[model samples]
Target: MITRKRGAYTGRNKSSAYKDLVWTVATTKDTTLPLETQIQETLQIIDDNLKELHSNKHQIVSAQVYLANIKDKPVMDEIWKKWIGDNPDHWPQRACLGVDLEGDVLIEISVTAVADL
Candidate 1:
């Protein structure tokens, strides 16, 4: 069976899970914010989404970061490193890509993790 968690954004599921894997994605609601703030907000949402799925950042196996500007990657990397932190167990195999996002969205992140069964 597949489980989908509802969210306030566009009638879409904030995260969806099948068996033991959960896929989640997030971006800041306030798209007008600067890159740093957007990233911060998006990560915070992902943190909550994971917890709701009985998972956490440490359980993330993969992450894909979408950026409106490729030049912002360095800054995004710094914030990401700080949040994911020093533990190897907390690090995910992540990739960042430059993409044209809707509106003023500076960054968006999608992750896949192992959720509690």
Candidate 2:
């Protein structure tokens, strides 16, 4: 079975979690900020979306984070540590990669999770 949870954002909720899937994407970017600032902001957005999914029956199974610069990994890791510390149990398969960003954005993530049957 599948279902869509709705809340608030612009047009639709920021996240979508199905009975057997967890769909999460980072919120809009802070274009004027530095790379580190953007990365932290993006992580916070991910956290909020993940928390909403946790309120339902699904659990995060994996996360793929993208960065605009590989050299910024250290800074990104620092923020990631703090975020993960808050909800240790929700840890999922994770990976980070360096790639060309869409625009002024420095970070983005796509997460997958599973809802209990």
Candidate 3:
């Protein structure tokens, strides 16, 4: 079965114990917020939507990040570490790169997670 929520989409099996979730990012035109702030807010949006599916899940399996400026990478790295934590075992497979993000945005992150069904 498949389900869509505010920030995440999920595929589930009633008899199975796991569900796959895809986080959807929000796009905005306002550029006044700091890059790190935007990243944090995006994560929170994903979190809020995930609550409708399962609330106790914490580990992410993979992530893809896009940044409008390579110059912002250092700053983004610092904030990402704080948000995703520093544990090696818990770290998800990730790919980050500088790109022309939408709406002149500084950054965007997409995550995939497996959670209890």
Worst 10-residue lDDT window for candidate 3 reads 8-17
Please give the CA lDDT of all the candidate structures: 0.94, 0.70, 0.62
lDDT tens digits, residue span 1-117, model 1: 998999887878889998999999999989888889999999999999999988999899999999999999999999999999999978999999999999999999999999987
Model 3 steric clash pairs: none
Task: Summarize candidate 3's per-residue lDDT along 1-117 as a digit string, tens digits.
Answer: 656553222562211123455444443235668787777775665565445556321666777778898788788778778876767877788888889876757777666666655
Sort by TM-score, best first.
1, 3, 2
Best by lDDT: 1
Better of 1 and 3 by TM-score: 1
Instruction: Name the lDDT of candidate 2.
Output: 0.70
Tens digits of lDDT, candidate 2, 20-113? 5767778346677987678678777776676666633126678788888878889888877776666767677789899987777778877776
TM-score between model 1 and native:
0.95
Number of the candidate with higher TM-score, 2 or 3? 3
Best of the two (1, 2) by TM-score: 1
TM-score of candidate 3 against the unseen true structure:
0.73
